[model samples]
Target: MLKSILSFYYQMQVFMFNWIDVEKLVGLFSFEQYDPVVFGTSFFLFYFFAFLFVFRILAKTKDLKVWTIIFFSIFFYYKAAGIYFLLLVFSAIFNFYIGQWIFNSKNENFRRIIFFASIFVNLGVLVYFKYTNFLLEILTDLQVGQFNPLTIFLPIGISFYTFKAMSYVIEIYMEMLEPVKSLRNFSLFIFFFPNVLMGPIDRASEFLPQIEGDFSVSKEDIGRAVFLIIVGLIKKHVIADYIGLNFVDRVFEVPLRFTGTENLLAIYGYSIQIYCDFSGYTDMALGIALLLGFKMRKNFNFPFMANSVMNYWQRWHMSLSLWLLDYLFKPLQMGLRNMRGFGNAFAVLITFTTVGLWHGANWNFVIFGLIHSVFIIFSMLTKPLRTKFYDKVGLANSKVVNFFQIVFTFHLLMFSGVFFRAISFDSALEVFHQVFTFMKPEVFPQFLESNTFIIILIVLGYIGHFTPQKIVDKITSLITRMPVVMQALLIAVVIWIVIQVKSADIQPFIYFQF
Candidate 1:
């Protein structure tokens, strides 16, 4: 009987060991094309919880904490971008050494050479990955060459991290910031996964100092982080995805099939969808960073309420806007200062055009950028006249006037967003054509009845957006004061709602393409 029992146990052990699929287990740590690990996914959540546990254990040892986070970040990137994570490491190393070289060199001529060369190398990689096919298409169109486009895998977040790396080098060259002495810390800045994919484009000057200190997280920070994460979940999975899948995508896909009013509403819907989607991602990123004991700058500020194009740019994607202003526009404007107003105008045109191009490699984006540039120039030129007119009409401080201005500015931006959202220039034009030629106001009742849920969500989104700052602050403060258990319950509820509302297939954030 003892011999029989021992034999049975050995057999069971063999069967149990066989059940473990070693290849599958290894695949979990590697990238899967169909199941790329990203924020808000089940795999990422599991990975994050595991990471948090490890992080807590190592928190007291500063070096261990930093290295642990770095390893986690590397694994995160590898799961997200596969072997391209190596590209990120190479870029980080290259830029780090370049910044140090620029800082240490005293020869002005050599510094300029290194500066331009580094810029070229950085931009060259970006151009090769992002615009090669674009340029090839252009050449084909011109009949200069009929070459086939090459297959190139764009490493996720190349645009964002490249900008961050360039800014680091630029700051050092400009003497505005010092080069990081330790490569490990520099790598952490670039590899920091929180805002890695989409970013407020955190600066080395602002981010590196925090790395020098010990890791810490306060109760208030935890509360705020929870609040922001919950809010982000609602915005993304609830509002943006719901409206987009049901309304905006249908209309934009085939604008001619919808009535003019429906087409117009789709445009408005897209504006809300994109804002909620992009800003939602930003909110989650900020919250995640906070949980890791770091603070990132804010990226948006109720952009829909802007009263002018200038105000809209200031409030919308404020990080990119500020980066452009500080690095591109200001530099160009200074270079052209000899020509005064004409130079300023030229700089604005060029800078905004670059802004549009930066969004994508397409003519529609170019048109979108041009449209903003023209409006911005007009806004600048008419500022004095508008000021005089408001003063003359005694409406400079009129609330009614301000409301109309806000509405008008929003419509202008919404119009530009058509190009931004549409699949092609032709598709964008079709949307406008439908609105202008086939607008059937009589179908409004039917449309409203059919899309009641989407419309209500849109309305609610805008209402939340336009809420006064004080009221929003109060809500955040209330959430922050909640007990830890309450906060956890709140997060759980929000997540449950997200799971219930989310479509069968997860909708990737719109800006991911950019």
Candidate 2:
């Protein structure tokens, strides 16, 4: 009996050792996968709470906190983009030294050269990863020696972090801000992980100080954080994913398969899907940053309520839009200021075209930008005539007239979204063709009946979007006062709803690609 027991124990030990390969175990914990840590995943949630315990302890120690965050952030980037974490390290060190040099330099010509050098390095890397294939395709189309596209691996968050790095140097060159003294502090600012992937695009002027300040989170802050997280989860999982899976994806995937009415509805559905998807990410990012005792700038402000293309840009993706405006549009406009409205028109066109290309390497994005620019320029040029027409019709003061204007603007933006959401330019044109040529009013009722749940959510999403800010603030204030147990229960309820409404496959956040 003793010899049999010894044999069984020996066999069990061998099985355990062989089953768990050490290398595989190490790989799982390392950057073997492209699974970057993102919010709203079960694995991320577990990792975050566990990390939070250690983070809180280190938070009181400034240097320790900064280093700890830097380490974890690097690790987080690795999990998200594998070895691209090294690219982040390279960016941090490179930018830190360059920014300091630019700041400390006294010679005007030298400063200018350094500034352009910074732009070249940052944009050069961006172009290599993001536009090599695009430029290759263009060469092929032009029959320029038939060069094949290279297999360029775009590191995740390259666009975002590169922008962050460029802004740091640019701001120093402009004398708007001083260079950060500590390399570690600068690294923390660029790679806070919360706003690193899809960004509110942290400004050095804004984010740098928070690293050195007191690390404390107020009760209201906790409430706001949880509220934002819940709102984001609902928007992403419940509204965006649900509608995309049920309606928009199908219609967009095969535009000709559906009737014109369905295509139009799909356009409307896509506008909501993108808003929920993007704004949901913003909510979670802001919430997570708040939990960490850092505040992120607002990225969305009820963009769908905008009454004009210009207003839409102002509200939607405010971070990127404003960045382009200050750094890109303003400079270009200044260069052509003598041309008056023509200059403004030129700058607006150029700026938004860049904005479109910033989204992806596609002609569809270019057309998307072009369409909005045309509408905006046309509106600006004809503003006086529009105002006179409104006065002549006695509709200048009419709320009903205002409502129609809002609807018109919303639909115009929705139309532009077709190109933005379509898989290709041909697909987008086909959708437009179907809208005008094959719209069947007779099938509308059946379609509406079949998509009742989706319609309800769409309506609710918009209503919530357009709801007064004060009302939202009031509701959030009340939530902040809830007992811990109640908040826990509310979270449990949210998770249950998410589980119930989630699509079969977890769709990635739309903006993560950018």
Candidate 3:
């Protein structure tokens, strides 16, 4: 009996040990889980509020609050990217110290060297993880010796955080802002989980000041945060994911199988799909930041409302566009100011090219950026001509004229967005050819009938997007003004509705891949 009992105990211990697969646990905590923490996930929705509860308790003690928030942010990032959280901490430490050194160094020459070094280090890590494979492909195509691809997993949000680091160092080098005294504050700025993954690329000047203040939440702030969170959830799960799963993914995956009319409509669907998907992420980021009593810059502004390509860029991805304007376009344009029109055109072209390359390591993204560059440059060159024509036609201030321009500008973006969405140059070319040559008008009705649900969602998305700014604002204001409990109920309802509509598989935010 004693021997049998001992054998049973040994078997139980073996079973318990087998249950814990060390490799699997390591993978779980590593970059193996590529999907970042997003708004709609159960883990986030539940834990975020729990975090807020603890945060509220700590709010009275500013230092404790800051550290608590930092800890939570790190944990949040860990969930999203697993063990790659170490990269985040390393970046924070590296940048914080480098920024301090740059600011403290008395010699301008040394400061300049450190600035360049900072840029090199930050951008080098980014390019290695993001672009190595693309570069290898290019080399392979050129037959420039044998190149083996490296199995490097691109960490989520490296681009945003790298830019955050570079911006911090660049500003310090320029003497624009003082180096932060507290490492905690600087770390919070870089690794603040909400805006880190996808960003309005919060400027240190704008964000750092908030960190020093006492924490407080107003009714308006609560309302606005809840409103944005609900809107973001609907945009992601209800509209973006639904349209993607039903229409956009199917059409893009096998464009050749669909009719030309289907392909053309797919482009339109993608325009709305990407807008809803990306803007959804930004909305959630903004909302989450607001809850933390931090304000992020607006990242989107109803881009479809723009009347020209130049106007479109200003509205779409406003943070990145403005970043390019401030750091890149202004500097290059200033240097080439002597060249006049040629310089302006050159700067615009180069800026968009950088913007394209920043999106991903694809030639397709390059083409996508170039397409916008051409449109914007053409718009610039013809600005006077367009003005003259509008004045000649007595339509300079005409609502009708503005309407047509908005439509034209939107379609131009949609056309460029094909390259943005396509897997390769040849695929984009095939799409272009299909839309131009094989467009069959007769299939529209049947396609609509077959895809009535998706068509409704797509139409609704555009309607919401193009709705007058004032009406949307007023609606948002009213929604946000409800009592706190009512707001929570509203969010609960939205989440429940999302549950009903969401696809079986969660679609990661489109921008998370960037």
Enumerate clash totals for all models, in the order shown: 0, 1, 1
Indicate the residue-level lDDT of 88 in model 3: 90
- Model 3 Cα lDDT, one tens digit per residue, 1-514: 9999999999988897799887866654444365565778886777788888888874668887898889888888887777788889989999999999998999989888988888888889999999999999899999997788899888888888888777788787778989899999999998898888888788888888999877677777777888788888888889999999988888888777777898988899999999899888888888888888888889888899999999988899898888889888998999999999999999999999999999999898899889988998898899999899989989889999899999998889888988999877888888887888888889999988898999999998898788787986786788777777888899899999999998677888888778
lDDT of 2: 0.87
Candidate 3: which pairs clash? Answer: 29-83
TM-score leader: 1
Report the lDDT tens digits of candidate 2 across residue range 427-457: 9989998999999989988988898999998
What lDDT does each candidate get? 0.88, 0.87, 0.86
| TM-scores for every candidate against the unseen true structure | 0.96, 0.94, 0.93
Clashing pairs in 1: none
Measured on C-alpha atoms, candidate 1 has an lDDT of 0.88
Spell out the clash pairs found in candidate 2: 36-80
Decide which is better by lDDT, 2 or 3: 2
Off by over 4 Å in 2: 1-28, 32-34, 58-60, 388-398
Better of 1 and 2 by TM-score: 1
